[model samples]
Target: MNLFAALPEKERLIAERFDSLIQDIKPLNSKQLAFLPRDIQRLSALLTAERSSLKAGYMNNAVMLSAYTRYFMRWNLFRLTSLFAGMDTTAFDFLKDGDYCLDIGSGPLTVPIALYLARPELRGKKLNWYCMDTSQNALALGENFFLSCAARLQTEEGEPAWRIVRVKGEMGTRIKNKVSFVSCANMFNELYWDTHNPLEKEAKKYAALLLSYTVPQKAVFVVEPGIPRAARFVSLLRSALIRSGMSILAPCPHEGACPMEGKKGGKWCHFILDTESAPKNLQALSEKAGLPKDRAALSFVFASSSPAHQSSSKPAGGKTAGKSAQGASRQHIRICSDPIVLPHGKTGRYACAHWGLTLVTGHRIKDTLSGDLLYADLSAQDIQALPVDRKSGAKIVNV
Candidate 1:
């Protein structure tokens, strides 16, 4: 039986609350953060642990972190590439009466949950969804969250919008359905660059295969970190889409070489920084991420194009080619008088506060490696059902 189906409506308010939190990237003040149930706070702490380097273990850290971090950390940085590449897929192009959609690297809400939020029009249609993810822990986090969230869907009428048929699989596998959209976000960087998972071969394999099955009305989005691999992927997808007669809806136009060239890829990327009180470790990581080491507050967008991606590859009276995209991206800003803040676990005075909190440690509380607190390394393999423990010990779950 579905666990959430048994809960009363009042018990399910977490989802709506979560949606609000993610939308504005607002952090909870000490007063607001204090209101969260202790259990949820603990959940955040456990899930927020850093353990991306540990591959041999249960990957328990990734699981809990994903379950905990309802969305990307509020202060997470954005570059031009990452911004558009990861531009919330749920927000646009969702069609009414659409038959099927495929979630490539669909970890948690990347598809189903987002579809429900972004596409109210699609609520009328029978949304048949297939979420393909490699991490069991991520899938687990997704399934449980979905179940919990479903219990709380307060509809204008009754019941929630969007019915999902989510499945756990990898991207290369053939999905025979005429996919309305295939969105793959920020995964290519990890796959081709970080893990080098031979996605190059896979891109041609499945993307082309899907295009072969569909007509011009269909679409597929290959989202990556705006690096070389991402650039290559986009270039490949563009070539593939052009070959298949599909048009570019977003990212305006490919401005330059996709930003993912050898060393330049990492340099062009940016990280969010609050220099006044950043932890030494986290600060070092930001610098390593190609951000300025000394700057206290910054937001960046990375793109790999060399202005070739602009609608005009040629410059306009020395105005430059990529300036329109640069201006367009800049004009769409996330400026808020009050930036979202989260507690750093240190009792210090900080301007921002967490709208929500997530526990994300991968190693057992007793394990020394659990001390590292990192995000972005989360996957399906790391999350587990949080069994009560003397301290939060890592639990190896069955996938």
Candidate 2:
């Protein structure tokens, strides 16, 4: 189920406001508009292939900043919206009426804007948002865009419930107050670019730094590109946080070591979301720039200082199923891969459980997708009867 599908009116409003904001920032002539696609392509290369050459202050360049807002920022917003929509509601329960949220590397206030659109219940909360970024220009532009969206969505007159505080710096910036939530989105890759340090060491260093900003009962969210390196980083970060006494809240059903980590052939953890519900103009712009996106893929980790809970017992789509029989063994498995076609008209998917990586195969597996939690009732005898795959050595269970 596409949770974003229900917000067509909200999506349209955001698209219209975003277009108007960009025009207001820089009114482009026909010639400039024609060259916008090329500019976007160049920026994309800097963010992907030539990322090592990118400087911390690259957003100071007007053309590059405008290109990012026009292309990358919009896509990121949609991606985050989809992520928040599919997440369990309890993950965000730490956000109360009076809480502070520190967003590190908050380029153009993407996280704030996404929260407003995806979580409507948060709109009325008297929350304080501290947006931190290296580029002052991006911070200012993001603040303007956030306010513009808020003005349109806010129905009751008086003052807006959310407050924005722009801090012009990167991670480790001195924040005076302890925050309840800390979010870092699409920024860690830039920080560790061109580094030769081991992923576990780097994850430990960064995890300690990020946790310093939060108080008790704190929550942290980190998102990165779905590429091999970034996903590996997320896996390592998950391990580091767990070692630091934090609980893994999403994407991982168990606190055990990641089975996909250090696997041969660069197997990493990541998930994909369909982009069909994205704005039409964004799709057209992507095609024009020769960068069509059928799906938005990312690797992320959500952790909390609170103890881990047994919330994965519920089935996918956030719905609870009836209780099992007295002696029936229940297992929660997190689907890690898309449906894999097997021989003889059967389907298979790689999953993660308390034991380790598992290969779940069955006749009818079309209903589940990547990043879904599959609840299975299997007894000890059922488990003992399953076969194992040779390549990955994962036990095969027919559901």
Candidate 3:
């Protein structure tokens, strides 16, 4: 039986809303939806105010709190709803019926909510769901709404169903200090730009934030907006975690240079018009798993010197994590391919998307806590192209 088969009817209902949101927005085909769910404007605004808030004190700043609150929840939702619908099963499949989880930038608790709703088996465990974000108001609203909405399931047969704490702070840093799994969704580029494009100091803060929150853990899942850079971002983060010595359990389904990153560049993110209009890459697969290629492509720039694993585990102190603290910090890259089948009678192989590539990295270290290789840093190798036409077999593996 599938793991999601035993969830509550209500939970399944809410999850369907997420699905509805995807269909309604139509981010893939719709020109308008393309660059949207725009959390950047909100991000920019929040960053500006956050700088101000610190001047006096966080206390009694209703205005700052208001903005902070909205920013946090909206950002969380913007980052993850798509992810929950896209992913089939993940590395954290081993989570107990109930366990502690950290949803970094947990847009409205998309990951945690979906996981709980989709898998009701986790109903009784003490789910100390940590919701960390820089928007305090966002966290407050999100937490309150969640508490109210989820109150019914808080307990079953006299046991606490879920205990969530929404903390308003930046991701990429420590919160509560420990966790089983940490989910960073749709905030990569934003945080990446923080160092320079968005604001250099913000960038460093984000990096430090992640490093602070990441190192000591069992499993950490890093998901980006399914844009051109999303895959690359995840790849780099995956490499870093692995280098830090974290065992990677369920990683993204894609194993290649994403389809969007050709010389011409490609679109970012995908949409679901309905169950009928899903991306072919997703439907044609053995399982409608992972962020599909037919979805908008995500691009990533590589760092040649250090492996993803090694770089990822680099401590916040600008220190590279040790093999003990950062298990996967060694240089071991993972190659991913979006396997496609060609037609016999037709001229070339049969794949829907225009182009695709595989993702590779360096560094391999067992996760310090879980003994998996996702606990450290990563260095990128390359995004080699797949040979096309019947004359060329997919050579994505060799690169």
Off by over 4 Å in 1: 1-16, 19-94, 147-153, 174-176, 194-206, 209-216, 226-232, 254-399
TM-score of 3: 0.49
What digit string (tens of lDDT, one per residue) describes model 1 on residues 228-287? 445555555554455444544333223223222223323212123223332343344334
lDDT of 1 at 8: 20
Q: How close is candidate 1 to the true structure, as a TM-score?
A: 0.46
Which prediction has the highest lDDT against the true structure? 2
In candidate 2, which residue pairs get closer than 3 Å at backbone N, Cα or C atoms, i.e. clash? none
Q: TM-score for every candidate vs. truth?
A: 0.46, 0.92, 0.49
lDDT of 3 by residue, 135-243 (tens): 5544554555555445545553443467778776665455654566566655565556334342333433443445454334345555544444444445445445444
Best candidate, TM-score: 2
| lDDT of candidate 2 over 26-87, digit per residue (tens) | 56777878998999999999888888777778888888888899999999988887777666
How many clashes show up in model 3? Answer: 94
